[model samples]
Target: MKPAAHVRKTALPGVGTRYDLNTEAGAHLSVVVHQDGRRIISFHDPEDDDACKDAAALAPAEATALSALLTPDPVAHLHQHLEIDLVTEHIPIGRRSPYAGRTLGATQARTRTGASIVAVLRRTDAFPSPTPDFRLALGDTLVVVGTREGADAVAELINGG
Candidate 1:
């Protein structure tokens, strides 16, 4: 029988698992998955086929960020979305806005907007993780996080719409 034409999988004690495969061009590639949701990808040093030189190691979040690169070129898809966009936006408060003179609690931002106000930026001051009791001001800019639709809801809630 010819050499097994499949990637080899090995268990890494106290760590996680490892998978290795040789490309048709004879280059060896390996990926190690750690129990902590981290991954290390490597390529064998061509000069020494017996040894692998780590190419990159990524934490779970970093890997997810890297996966975003796999999507189609963004500039080409500008009018069209390549993926669901979860974004952070800074929304300013106006004097007549409901959030202007009230505490965050009274607004029930999360309950009404389905978005999170993570922080607020006032003139020369920034409040992170502002509590529900924190009072809002006319010039305070809320740093919100959520999908576009959710953010729209938050804008409407702030403006009493």
Candidate 2:
């Protein structure tokens, strides 16, 4: 049988219910369901319990969309609960994108922006764990993960900064 996860439930008077989960990897995550249908998700710093490394306040629809992304793939769900304060974003390669016809390695996105391109979505096809040699094309959407700032920097770099 699979091991059970450690979680704590807290009630905030007039605010909402908060669920704190401690992952097996030693990462901390918190989800607050507000009284007004908003959801706040946050990742805490492992070294400092009082510090929040990353957080996002999501509307009901946005929460649903996030749920959809995490539901089908167990790996994706697991990564979401990991200790890293990283976020996943889909960044599109536009017509003016400098890296459209270049190899992924040529962009050096990870080295330059600290974000890693995990996959690519081109038309109806999905390429998971794309190699550095992968050739990018216009309209292709890059699936990247890192700090929010890192992801944004990647988008900026891909668009010629």
Candidate 3:
């Protein structure tokens, strides 16, 4: 089981408030709400409670951008999560997506499109190279592998466009 996030908010007397977050993955983030309407961010040691992990003190906008940059987008995370080969597209399974609620075998996905649905991301878990008999679900992110044209064909095949 994964550890839950631990956060603490404290009033820093005349300075302002301090918000500290201990993330599930052992990351530590601290933000100081200064009385001057500025925030001082700090990176604390995930292992050592007293020592800092790295560095940073940024304005709100800078803080946001830093956070955004640190956070990986869905596709980027998928690439990191999977053992990829050839080209791959993270195709979202929407309601109108033809593969939704359908069996992979029924779609003849491999036989027709030449794009292999090597993995499916459903919520938090990833199903890699799922069986042909496995049924696809709505909101699943299908990891397809092939050439650009083949990927496009697979997308078109599923979207019925």
Candidate 4:
């Protein structure tokens, strides 16, 4: 069995958390996850611990793509090729939303915005492929699958446009 590499985690006050790891090849690498969901990957110079040889900043979406590439999950590989054009978003129904007490059919999300509500997350329970008659509630998170624009439209519509 291959031994697990030890990763050191450091807290950067007022900045973010950093995870440092030494590769089997003796290279130093670190990844920082910021408060706003941004990520920075850095390769350190062996001679100078504080010096960075190269660095790359990645947005949340870019980081997700990079993570998928490095993951061994079979399901993750299936959607890698379709990452560019397809987008999956989770939209929350707020307390002030007009559809909070209404049925899913009222939104007409798929017809009007072209986004499909594949699931609804209510507390710890998940309702998959919810029917149009499914009632919406505050704090329910809608799992939507569609283009970016379509997801944005769904958010706007659910929040009373």
Provide the clashing-pair count of each candidate structure: 0, 0, 0, 0
Alpha-carbon lDDT of model 3: 0.78
Report per-prediction Cα RMSD to one decimal: 12.6, 11.7, 11.9, 7.5
Off by over 4 Å in 4: 1-84
**Candidate with maximal TM-score:** 4
On a 0 to 100 scale, what is the lDDT of residue 151 in model 4?
Answer: 93
Model 2 / residue 2 / CA error / Å: 28
Write model 4 residue lDDT over 42-140, tens digit each, in one string: 999876769999999998756866885776764666786665766788888997689998999999999999999999988768999999999999988
Task: Decide which is better by lDDT, 1 or 4.
Answer: 4
Question: Would you estimate the TM-scores of all the predictions?
Answer: 0.48, 0.50, 0.49, 0.53
Please give the CA lDDT of all the candidate structures: 0.82, 0.89, 0.78, 0.89
The list of candidate 3 runs beyond 4 A from truth reads 1-85
lDDT of 1 by residue, 1-161 (tens): 34655889999999999988787897888878999888988899766856877679987645655665655554665646557577677777877697788898988888877899999988668999999999999978888999898888888888778
Query: What TM-score quantifies how close candidate 2 is to the native fold?
Result: 0.50
**What is the C-alpha lDDT profile of model 2 across 37-150, one tens digit per residue?**
899999999888669999999987578668867665557668866888888888889988989999999999999999999999887689999998999999888999999999
Candidate 4 residue pairs in clash (backbone atoms < 3 Å): none
Runs in model 2 deviating more than 4 A are 1-83
- Please report how far candidate 4 places residue 21 from its true position, in Å: 12
Residue pairs in candidate 2 whose N, alpha carbon or C atoms collide under 3 angstroms: none
